[model samples]
Target: MKKNRFLIILTISVGLFLLSFSLSYQLITNKSEDNKIAKIENNKLENDDKNVEIIKEEEKVSPNTIIEQRILYKECGDLIVTNQTPSTDIINMTKEKYENYLTNKKPFLRVISFSSNKIVTWGEKEHLCNKHFIIGEEDGKIAVFKIGEDGERLLHKIFVDYPVELLMELDRDEIKKGIRVDSEEELSDVLENFIS
Candidate 1:
């Protein structure tokens, strides 16, 4: 009888342990799936796209055709640029910060600025510069450009909120050039000047 009682208790304990482990594993797996679903939903929101407009015959026109071309600008955040040309380390750091900032509600971005470059972003406003300096905006993500006196240029984006100390050391220039043109032809001219 004593032997039987000991065996029964041991079997019950092992069964309970296995059951608890399986339950915990399932819970964790379900939580991960839920997180993934949330991410997918957010991505859909980010990619909110519209149809493109192309001049064509009346027969080609459809109700779904977008009449007014829309340039979906990327959401902006509070970010500043620096005078330093970005290195591999800076790129990695900036990319990580950008990702983090995008995942959060509001984040500041600190970007290293360089001389003479045109940086393009999907953000609300297009920012341009020729001098090595920093520009700050209320928008979180900023693309940085550095163009040299020789007309060489590079483009990079800052995706995260960094400390002010890193950006404070650099100089800032606010002189605005022709960033917003009324027509696409003028935009091309502006871009040409930027690259040249």
Candidate 2:
């Protein structure tokens, strides 16, 4: 009887030990799988964030876009002028309309004289002639002038603040006729000597 009892207790103890070992092994494997899944989820979130940043960068406006939207102007000392019409009008102006505008408009005059003694002479001719369109502002206000056949009849007032730019467009014919200036000084000299 003693031998039988001892064998029965030993059998029960061994069975309990094996069951506990199997349960522990299963728990460890499940914890490891959970960790791997969490890591994958974190990586996916990081990738998503990077993708969003790239999209935002692409949507930002570029300098070239801003430049394209604004009219191109030429810069002289404290003055900006353009031969072209206002940006809005130019966009809608037909070639025939532009030619008519030019034919009816008076020529613009600009003068700059820098002497050896540092004396500077600057002026402009904004005669009304037939060109009544408001090309642009001298400063921020509309540049107003009267029709004049000579520089003396042109206005000498400063329309805007100093250091302004003017935007102008020349036709192919005008360019062929030597209507282009290499610099502001050159433009001023040409205007001072212009016959028309």
Candidate 3:
């Protein structure tokens, strides 16, 4: 009976120690898993910061370097490609920003792109006829255009908040499609259709 009591006590002690060890191992494993997750999150944040830095670098422009530059000018039926030395202002702007400012903009474009020694820019104003520019009514306002040699009008300028009543007074097809004149003075004469 004494031997049996000793054996039973020994068996209970062994079981309790094994239970405690198993619980400690489970806790260690959970802590390791949590640490791994934290490291992964930190790496992701670092990568995101690096990506933003890269984008900022890409947007930076050298302020003093002279790059190849050119303008695509429309003359009559021909496209005249003009190569030019870039100004300090042009060198300061990124091509995408300059292009945005000039896309559908007037007078002359700021810059287009850079490739093959031709820095890019363009403004399509027709030159085949004597008229340097044309004017007409469109989208509820007076607008001006540059015609290609193909005689297709390209948007050049627009008038905002032009009187609706004055626009209604115009029925002349020449003023509606466009008026061709030799200079800005003649262009204004045609513009009279939209005015008093």
Best of the candidates, TM-score:
3
* Candidate 2 lDDT for residue 56: 31
Winner of 1 and 3 under lDDT: 3
Cα deviation of 39 in candidate 3 (Å)? 9.3
Question: Mind giving the per-residue lDDT tens digits that candidate 2 earns over 80-129?
Answer: 33322233432333334433443465223211221122212223433222
- What are the runs in model 2 whose C-alpha is more than 4 Å off? 54-196
lDDT (CA) per prediction: 0.39, 0.39, 0.62
Query: Worst lDDT window (10 residues) for model 3?
Result: 64-73
Candidate no. 1 TM-score: 0.25
Ranking by TM-score: 3, 2, 1
lDDT string for model 1 (57-110, tens) is 322222232222112222222233322333332242333453354346222222
Say which prediction, candidate 1 or candidate 2, comes out ahead on TM-score: 2
Instruction: Rate residue 50 of model 2 by lDDT.
Output: 82
Worst 10 residues of 1 by lDDT: 171-180
TM-scores, all candidates, are 0.25, 0.28, 0.30
Best-fitting candidate, scored by lDDT = 3
